[model samples]
Target: MRRSPWATLTVLALAQFIVVLDVTIVNVALPRIQTDLDFTADGLQWVISAYTLVFGGFLLLGGRAADLLGSRRVFLTGLALFGVTLLVAGLAGTPGALIAARAVQGLGGALMSPAALSILTVTFAHGRQRNIAMGVWGGLAGLGGTLGVVAGGLLVDSLSWRWVFFVNVPVVVALIAATPLIIRAVARRSGHGFDLLGSVLSTAGLLALVYGVVRAEPVGWGSAEVVGCLAAGVVLLAAFVAVEARSAAPLVPLRLFRSRALSSSSGALALNGASFLAMFFLTAIYLQQVRGASALRTGMEILPMGAAAILVAVVTPPLVHRFGTRTVQLCGAALSALSLLLLAGTGADSGYASHLLPGLILFGAGVIAVGVPAQIAAVVDVEHHEAGAASGVVTAFYQVGGALGLALATTLSVSRSHAALADGMAQQQALVEGFHRGLLVAAAFAVVNVVVTLASPRIAPSAEQIAEAAATA
Candidate 1:
């Protein structure tokens, strides 16, 4: 049976929503989870970090699996794993068990996210339809993080924090049931063998990299464990690259990076993710700790950010049609940096309506503008067969960048706060100063992206180029 492209998108979007939602849903519930699970202060961070580490680590494998095994098969398999793990996490009685469940849940997300994206890339032809589809995907991705906060607060306030994990179970079940009916499966491509060595090297390398970066926040960056993990990650990833350069069947095709559009988009997306996620972390802390707002109220306050992102997602494609993608990306990056600069101006007594709303709204709009184009550019010119690999590269960049950003921001924030306390500043004032420093780091990332965007080729591939590339493939 033929399925409407819209129906296919709906199913994919819902699956992705839960995947992205899990990234930040636990933020507001962290304290509750710690209390209930008796998590040590240092151990509590893993509930969030475990998911991030595994999710970022396994994305490349998942994307390649979709290419070799079939996107629909990988998507469904991931969905099932994700659903089961969410159930286990919700019911977990011990801290270790919950963290274990979260780690497996990250694995499921790693598989589902890129597979769904590959499906979308192939389903819609390039041009207006593809832009609109990616716009929706980009918007949903941004909205998921924002909604996670809102949903987390509501669930934790009215129910237990366990509901944060449980809430997605029903959605997962629905997506599993609905997917096959709407989207037909493609047969796996022949003539391509799985690259086992590349898979192991890339996955282990990414896992080590993420683990080191996330761990650096709690442990000093100078610690032996951090230094060892970072060194191992770099060496392993370098080896993975060398292996791919020689392999007949590479896990990630080196040729893909030759496309200036895809390469630039990957880099820009990393900086974009870094800025956006770090900003969220900084603002969330500012709301709860500085203003002393309830979780529910903080979520409500952040609602406008999502609204602005949706608005930009809807409007950006047309702007790209007229102004060109590079223009819009530059403007978006500028706005994002400006938003963070504005946010950095917030004092200990700053009011939400007067001080914070402008930046929040601009951030929402800015991130979507940059993200929608980056998302489109990453897969738009790639051959259909390599769409999964292209998707994985960009998605991996964003996830890894987000993890790095959060870690850096947390370390900077804590260090600044402690320094201020040493100088005998009031606790509230010192905390706000630390948040300011973190916001500046986020703003710096966006500013750096501006330079990155300026240095890259044009955002959209020309029609002639796309055709020639397609013919070449």
Candidate 2:
């Protein structure tokens, strides 16, 4: 890189942090947004769901375009789009305008994220530098969630909730302008013809799938809209797989799945994502509603989890070097399950220190253990041309997993809460009962991860062994 490689990484890392931050930031500001826009309780969720649906749906397409069209160009375009819509969202006076803006923001995120990851992967050679980059990338993802909650609470309390939307402008503008100066551009390679049909099927299919999952909580799975969406999603996705298998220049190269490293990493990421989201959703509710903590205080309590994840992220490269990717991933899964089981013990009267903190720390460390190495495994074998698409697949699994996990947890928790209420438990106590059940389900997912990690063969070679083999070969 003509510019310092670290400079390129810093800019890309900042951009990604902003992207992930938006995912959770608006949550703290939801009440303010609802009141300001006069949004019905039923309609308010669309603000968040719209972003996730579009972001998850089009990610693969975005990643493919980055590889074929040009990662630098795609990254800049997406960043610009996100910045523009962010301003529009901040200025929006009506519910429709804000919701529409949020959807567009998701599009920008879809376009930007994989391109950024692809760029990062190529910027540093695949070794210690690459591992460091992955650690930063993964760590930023963890930090972003905590920052979102804390920053959102501060911004909303000190200023208007609109600041949550407005805050992206400076960071994005800087990245966009710095792109040419700091980031080296990669030469474009010849690609197979664009698979338009596959693209449409994949994008539409994912959108429908995520939309269905998102709606399941509010409307129930039996609702016509939900059932129709879920069925159509399944069919369209099946069609997408078929198209990819046949297409010469498929958006997602089916052959990539031939790499156990990439495929298994993707699966593990999905499970980790499920556990992560379930923990976030359940714990937040437990703090705010059951424990009567303020939004800022809850954010404060969650800060340690982020801190722990970051700490693990820093040490993970060495751990992988000594232990290998499979071992790190397996141990992480085990830790995550243990953490969830700890959390499952939470009661209506439980204190954060006595109960939540131990679980949160373990969960955070476990996520880093799971996420950083899985990320390394995902793209370790990738050629430059496939980096973007591979990144997209990993990202897609995470988004889908999070949506599915959250839906499952919410359904289980709500049902349990209802049962408790019917059995004459107080509202608060009933809510706690439901939360406990939901947590156990979350714990179960982590345990399942343990089984899968144990059963699945090692996806990638040990770090030093791969380096040595590459040298000899």
Candidate 3:
């Protein structure tokens, strides 16, 4: 029986939104969580780091499982685990319990997010239909980050902090009920069993790498712990590559990288993700430290950016249909760099409407234009079975890149602030100076992406090529 494509899209997109939302939803609630749970300043970061590290680590395994075991099965399993952890975190009696639950939640996100995206590829045939679906999906991916900030502020302010975790219950219940009707089951598999060695190497390598990048902010880049983890991660990732080359059912097929365009697309997505994350971090700081706003106010102030992203996201798919992915991508990157430049010009005295709003809107549109198109190009040439793996890789870039970018930006901000303070600048003045420094670096990243996109061969993959890839998969 054929299911309604739009309905499937809604389910998949909503599932992903909630998963991504969790990434930042707990951020604003941390103060309250700390008060209730006796969390110290140093230990509190674990709330965020635990989830992201595990999430980055397990994404490949989860995506491959969706393909081998079946999307429906993997999706439901992840949903169940996520729901269970949500409840555990909500009802936890101690800081340790909640942190542990959050870690599990990250693993749950790793399992569900890629499987949900994979379902979209098979549900909507490639071309206009898939492009539109991806537009919405990619838009939500962009929106979720901003939405998480706003949603966290709203929930934490109006209700108890526990509500942040508890809010997922009804949504999870509804998704589980709708799963059988909306999701198509994959055919029974006859193949080599799961690649245990590949999964371990990939997961461990990513875990170590993300951890090192994250730790770099507080520990500094040269710390022994950071260096050891990064070195270990490099070695493990290298081993994973060698293992994937030999395995029959590799977690990440090496052939996927055979296309230079696809590989470039992934790298571009990482750069885009890095810029977007760092931009938001700096803006949030501007609102809070410079403007003297509360968490709720900061969230409200950021709302305009998310709205702009949604508007552009809706229109970008059709634009891509008419204009092509490369054109859209290049234009988006150029605009993003401009937006960062505008942001960099601001200071403690800049007004919201005059100085900030224009750039915020530009950034909103810029992220959608670059992100949606880059995602489309990445999977446009892949087969259905490979869709899950491809989705996993794409999302991993977004996750890992965002973490690394935030760490880099945070480090820059701290160093710049210290330098300014040493020169006898006021604390708030020094903070804004740091924000400028970070935004400038982020803009540089956007410029580099534009350069890379221009330098790459124009793929302009046609409808027939897409059809052939789908049929072969």
Candidate 4:
């Protein structure tokens, strides 16, 4: 008997959820890991950055592989590699060993993510089924981020920081076992050579850029090391563009940017990521540092945002249907910006219910609103055969944007806090001032998202219309 499409979707979603959950699960455990491993203040960040840099850098290549090779094979291989790397990371005793393992885990994630999405794209026929599948995919992606915080808090408080990585082992095992039964085998494309040159240039370029930005707080941006890294990154990225323009088989087809919807949606995703990442980082610190909450309490305080986001995600489809994707996206962006502004005003003495709850709820709702519509618009106009590539590009931008935002926020917050400390302010007051600055920056990014979303073309296909079109096609 064949597996139902819904079953296939569920399996794919679970795989993706596991991959995304790792992104935030490690945040709550960072302090614990630092104490255990004796990591330097700057060294601690590498734990997260190592994973993101490798994941973002190799995503395009991974997507292309799924298209040229078989998605199922790549998916299984990725899962196996990810599981192994996670095991190594969990068992790591030294900071160097953990960072290396994290980099390997990221490489595995880069492979798995695109392959999983490609499977979903091919498994579900376009129309109502595809829409529903995408909605579930987006929701799970959002929920994964939330779960990371809560799960990390629980594991870090009870067991050990290593449990965060150890947890992925069982999930990967289950997915690998079930994948063959759920996913249909597809023919591989022949005569599609991998764009080795383009991949090298792009990956190296992105890694260099991220490394430079992340190092700027410890090594001043004006320092020779920082400047050299930034310059090398720019030059390599420029070479990558030149290589792509001339290559017969490019890793990322430069022409895809010609699509107005894809371009707009990608831009919106970047801005959304920038704001959302900053919001999460600053709020986590604010809850812990300024309010003097424990890791568990801080995680619990942010639970409302996660719950609100899930609820809003459930209702987004109908809202999009009624008012159109553009309207909802713009509204969501506006709300997010407002929430950021509210957070920007929060002082050291501010109460969670009076100052934080309203902003968090508004931000959560806005994030879900922007997330669903932006994703819908991204693939709406993409070619069916290139769905994997398209999805990979979106995912890469999302991760890259997040990394950049966090790096910037970290630098800004630290600088502000140091300056306030120099001025004889209390530690809590200095931290709150730094958080306010960070939230203000997040608000500015949210405003940018609103403008970009408004520039996007309308997406208002009814469920019946979509189903009819899919059936006819």
* Predictions: Cα RMSD each: 3.8, 4.0, 3.9, 3.2
Residues 175-253 of candidate 4: C-alpha lDDT, one tens digit per residue: 8889898888766767668887886787788778777876776778898988999999999999999998988888778
Of candidates 3 and 2, the better by TM-score: 2
Residue 459 local lDDT, model 4: 84
Question: Scored by Cα lDDT, where does model 1 land?
Answer: 0.80
Range of the 10 consecutive residues with the lowest summed lDDT in candidate 1:
464-473
- CA shift of 114, model 2, Å: 2.9
Error of 2 at 417 (Å): 3.6
Pairs with backbone N, CA or C atoms under 3 Å apart (clashes), candidate 4:
none
- Positional deviation of 174 in candidate 2, in angstroms? 3.1
Which residue pairs collide in model 2, if any? none
In model 4, the Cα lDDT at residue 223 comes to 89
lDDT value, candidate 3, whole model: 0.77
lDDT of 3 by residue, 1-473 (tens): 88898999888888888887776677656667877899743355467656765676678878777877888889999998998999999999898999899889888888887677668778888677886787677567667766887887788778887888899788998999999998878653457767779767876787677667656656778999999999999999899999999998776778987766667777788888778877876676567657777667777777888888878876876677677778988999999999999999998888888988899989889987887667767777666556545656766776666656665665677678778989999999998898898899889889988987786546465554433332222
Give the alpha carbon lDDT tens digit for every residue of 73-179 in model 1. 99999999999999999999999999899889988988898788778878888767776676577567767977888998898889998999999999999999999
The positional error of residue 70 in candidate 3, measured at the CA in angstroms, is: 3.2
lDDT of each: 0.80, 0.78, 0.77, 0.80
Q: What is the clash count for each candidate, in the order shown?
A: 0, 0, 0, 0
TM-score each candidate: 0.86, 0.85, 0.83, 0.89
